[model samples]
Target chain A: MKGKIRSMAYAARHDGLHAIRPPLMKRIADASAPYLYSAPALILIVAVMLVPLVLGVSYAFRDIQLLNPFSGAFVGLDHFRALSEDQAFFRALRNTLWWTGASVLLQFTFGLILALLLDKPFSGRAIAQALVFLPWAVPSFLAGLNWAWLFNPVVGPLPHWLYRLGLMSQPANILSDPQLAMWGPIVANIWWGIPFFAITLLAALQAIPRDLYEAASIDGAGPVQRFLSITLPFLAPTIAITILLRTVWISNFADLIIVMTNGGPADRTQIVASYIFTQAFKRLDFGYASAIALVLLALLLAYSLLIVILRQWLLSKD
Target chain B: MRAKSTFLTIAHRLAILAYIAFALFPLFWLLKVAVTPNDLLYTEGVRLWPSRASFEHFDFVLRHSSFPVFFRNSLIVSGSTAVIVTVLSSLSGYALSRFRFRGKYWLVTLMLLTQMFPLVMLVAPIFKILSPMGLTNSLTGLVIVYTAFNVPFATFLMQSFFDGIPKDLEEAAMIDGATQFVAFRQIILPLTLPGIAATLGFVFTAAWSELLFSLMLISGNEQATFPVGLLSFVSKFSVDFGQMMAAGVLALIPACLFFLFIQRYLVQGLTAGAVKG
Candidate 1:
């Protein structure tokens, strides 16, 4: 009887342990499930973006050139040294500020106006919204080409109209003149980018509680007053974030300038992003290009940090 | 007060009209020039309507140019990238939406960081890495690069869609002995078809419009996507405005179609993103 009881107890204990093991294993599996789901994307992003990013940063310090086979030696800070003396790099930097500033400011201003105009209900609003937003759907490259064609005096009417309005001495292509060349791409950038701002702003605009507007109006708030009291405050966060993101994005946008001008007319339109492309593609100097890119990356980070700090300060002040 | 309101209304309509005109005029000119006969192109001198419109340019572009090959290549790259990105992002997005994990915050931050950095920084490095792997100058290379670049935004987009779905449906399926993945597939995935379609369309247009990577990765005419091909065509035949515009119109077709497909969802998607953001 003692042996029998002892054996039964042992069996029960073993079975209990066995039961406990499965849940532990199951717990681990459950814990890892999210990671498993995200693993593929994470791996791809790491391999394709992160690894290349690190390698690119390393290239900033190394002598790496595409066409030159013997250019793999590590030359610390040599590219940066060269970049310090590159006048064109400085010019491109300034132009980037101009391009980004003008593009973002104009896009945001117009986008806000367009969003407000579209906010009210009207007949044919849906079709009007779609039509106005159609430009966003046009591929950026095609937008570039279309605008380039529009600015061409030979086949386009813009130059002739400008001359007729006395905005130009003659119907010469603005793209070919160094003084006016940057505007060609800037105009194209504005035209292509406005819809992006409009779409996002309109979304934010729609999210404002209808009751808020009604309340303001009931309080004898005129349109401008209501807009100031309610709409601006609601739109502020969206505006700040969008502008911050878009400033970085448009500064890096080299497509329009590249397609339209190739950064020519004495390189008047060559922003840093396009300059990086020109260096890598035209010069085959990957190291130098990477260096310029690193500087740009640093500047952008600093700008972002400043914005964050400013935002925190404002919040604290409030 | 009524007179003031009336004037305001008129001004609003006029302003909207002006914006519509500004937005459409460039695209309108593209279409206008595409159909204008070569004989009348310059001679028409910016006439609102051509004296005579012809499909001669389109006919030549379709029959003679290498645009057809570029179009096919672009279709293959973009279609494959869109499918792959949507599938992968759906999984990751689902994880992000449903699961509270240790690294979730960091993952989101990492994805946002990817958006901020200048992609041009990666151009040379990516080229160097791909060239030796025999992936350079191939459509597969373009697909891979484009897929990586687009997945981050698409993931956020898909995550928003997933958030819109109620958890009860999937939970019920799970209680019925279906695994989470199985529930996601069987119950939740079907309901998110609109979101999937929107993501697909968005990624497709993005991949189709990509210029920099395609230009860098693909060299030969056989592998050249539309943007690169169109650019090369421009350089080679700079004087062929009619033909180029016709090709431009051709390129616009798929994008516009995709736009129309996703137009209804665009505002909703942006709103969801903005709210979450």
Candidate 2:
């Protein structure tokens, strides 16, 4: 790679010297080229995303209301104090754990199975693969609404089917049932997210050398044994990184909950992210919303940091 | 042993079939509800296929509602975002792919940080920032935000594409007296067409599916994207299942089309950057 860059750089200067461009000017241009290429994207990200991020962090320290013009005063620690006493916030924190955990676990488990099944070539594999991966293409809010419809007994089928199967006493909407409400969004999330894991793991699975499996079989290793000793070990890195990234992403995902239940039925499905949205949009409490969002952000960062440390430690052990 | 192997093969096929059914059932249901006649919708409950089906809802959603406007706005916003993002990211991605320059580490980190942080945090502040500049409640604002949000991932994707192409091509061009940028434009860009298509598809679907930001930014029906329009419509008229699903099936068109177009490259494109933040 170093030699490649050097040769490219040498060629660049050679061209510069032959042309009207001075070698000094050529060197400066080459040095600034990457920056120029990246400048537009960088400027947009900073202005639109990063600036707002910093402002949001500051909003956590101030009292900012959407409707009130006089509500932008600096109010240090008040929102945090209210947050500490707020039961809804604590419940949301717990619900976030439940939502993210169940969604990721179920999605990964099903996704891994699907990937393994598809790893082998067969008739109609292309069509089947496309069909099975289709759900990931559904817009998330639509997915949530679709699932909500399924659970609703009015014109949908799931509740009726569940009742007929004796899982429920009668056909009823589970989203209105506090004990079962969170399941609505979690199920939607699992359905929507499974293909992500399946696709990634399938790619990783296909990359594994075919000869290794062939060799394992020739050596009299059973399917289960080969999976344990070969497949599992090979997939460890992708699984770890995928799970870590997915955990953060899922925890911050509130679209399903927001769409399906809107954190209703006594707030059973209200994860922290959804709670933040409610504060920001419903109550128009920008300051309080920013405070909650800050906490969620901190929690996600801590979780990511912990995973990084764990990964580093594991690497060191090896 | 032969029987056991045969049984395993059958089991695998069965498992795949089950997955296909599970993945497609809800979308099928969406279509089913959309087509079921309103009278049959309530009278004949829980049937896989209603006794009578109609395109009445589709007709209504298309001809007699605000959906056409929402559809146009979404296409405009998503298409513009996809095109703009693809262009910017190609340039940035090529730089990242070929050049080793100062502050590259920080640039990569900044992009990574944008991906990690909860964008829901930006709701209030982004609203505040855009409102002052009269960018709020406009499709242009949405295009700008979506473009910025997607650039990082698209850049990484484009970088992977550039990485796959041989560096020799560009070097040869430079040796022939073309500057690096010219070589990149004339030689490298044409080779990455599939990559460009994949990036465009990826960004289009993302922008198409964006919910909260558009919901926060666009309040009026005039500028509302499909998600915002459909969501607000669902909330206001919760009882209109047939019409809602019809609108939904309509919204699914561009995304599903893009999905089909890019399915071939999905794994290759994502696997390269999926590991990073």
Candidate 3:
């Protein structure tokens, strides 16, 4: 009877007699047709993203001085060699590393902790979550302004208050201090980063089935034990993806640095982004700036490729 | 089951309260300073509140400054960029999320590639290009540059949202005597209100506070966005803390209002693909 009914349904599907028909061939087409329809977006993305990227790569190799305007001379490794001799380039590179390294690690740490804390059910979690996410909503440039003032020494409220509370030796201009300025952006970044990390990890946390936790508990597993055994393993992939994305973002940041220090205190806070800005706009050294930009791009590209590899590795482990 | 769990729950709540306080302290301080009287600003030092409060600074900034001009310019730039980007990205994102054709993989790869580069790197070339077009020192140029820079990321954002929606609704509408564009407009567009709101808010706030391009492109205060205009408060000798902070406080208003207006969408967007809840 089951076979007879199946055969009749199959016949109806093949004949297209029914108003709604589900079949293997139709399902394949349905899945594929959307991809086919996405052609225009694909084209535009290529035009907008690909062409410029490739153009940038080619431009990086040439001696594209602004003085010449229209035509650029092809100079092979000369630009790279020139960059090696440049002290400001080295400072920027070092600063870029520091920015990416510190910001990415802290962002992950804070995001993870917040996500874990917020994962469990609690009263007022909704409001807490919204408040935590608020910083990410504000523009990054505005965030820099807010933090810059907060770190101000005399007229600024923070140092003034700190001194009043007997929390400091004296009024410290955190922004003007070379040692503190880099961290100024880092602090602002971490503040902005908390929400992104919290949201992503929280999603991963919620995906873990209650049954798994219950079973672990029944087996006499402690909270830490259960989390280590099940939660961490399940969350590894999401964490990896999140970190990769954030790393690329943190490295490419230009606004915060610009607004906060302008790579100042004698270029101590200059990251690759700020460095490029100075070289291109401030110094009018377009060729050298392009080279720096290329190098920055290369570093990020490596990270992007690593993300792909990590994703594949994740799938294989699963 | 009752007493021990209740005790633990209270501890958990306390911990969350601490975190919330930490997160909100800056914004609370912003409001606190905005309300604090100018004479009390330095005199009150680090105190959370002043012995006295007034609306004088807000009044002055509103009634007696170039702030209104900056505010109007910002609104125009941000609004135009958001609307233009959303429209462009809507079409492009639709194509990306719903279609398949030649070079699709490459196209996506290219978009991803664009995102990989530091945008500061492109500023020079962009300036060089825009300079000749006579776009510099103009709000239109700022809007165009922002639109260009924001399009790729916004397209990706819109695409993700489009992907969440089932294509069946549009197909169904098409089958029921609607053209593809009509189906997209009437059926699919309504469903994407949340996504549209997210894109608009994101682009608006982005262009609103953008300083680097505005500074590079516009040389004068006449066309300055608020972020650039804020820098004008600084001079060769000293920074005007009162005026700068007041302007900062005023700048916070539109952004706050913007988010407030679109908070519903932002909330929805945060949870879009996360979990069933």
DockQ of each: 0.64, 0.64, 0.29
lDDT by residue (tens digit), candidate 2, B23-89: 8899899999999999889888889998888999999999999999999999999999999999999
Candidate 1 lDDT, A1-318, residue by residue in tens = 999999999999888878898897889989999999889888889989999999999999999988889888999998898999999999999999999999999999999999999999999999999999888788889999999999999888899999999998899999999988999999988888787889999988999999998888888998889988899999998798778878988999998998999998898999999999988887889999999999999998877666545545644775
Per-residue lDDT tens digits of candidate 2, residues A15-84? Answer: 8776966777778888999999999999999999999999999999999999999989999999999999
True contacts kept of 2: 0.70
List, residue by residue over A87-188, the lDDT tens digit for candidate 3. Answer: 987888888889989988888887888888898886777778777777766666668877787888645567766667897678897778877778888888
Span of 10 residues, lowest total lDDT, candidate 3 chain B: B268-277
Kindly report the fnat of each predicted structure, to 2 decimals.
0.72, 0.70, 0.34
TM-score of chain B of 1: 0.96
- Give candidate 1's error at residue B198 in angstroms: 0.5
Segments of candidate 1 deviating more than 4 angstroms: A1-19, A304-318, B268-277
What TM-score is obtained by chain A of candidate 1? 0.90
Arrange candidates by DockQ, highest first: which order?
A: 2, 1, 3
Which residue pairs in candidate 3 have backbone atoms (N, alpha carbon, C) closer than 3 angstroms, thus clashing? Answer: A35-B99, A35-B100, A36-B100, A37-B99, A37-B100, A38-B99, A38-B100, A161-B46
What's model 3's lDDT at A283?
73
Judging by lDDT against the true structure, name the best candidate: 2
lDDT of 3 by residue, B1-277 (tens): 7998898888877777776876777777766766777788877777777788777767777788777888899999999999988888887778777777555666555555555556676676666666788888899888877776677677777888888899899989888988677888898888988889888887787788677778777878788778777766644223545566677777877777776666555534443221111
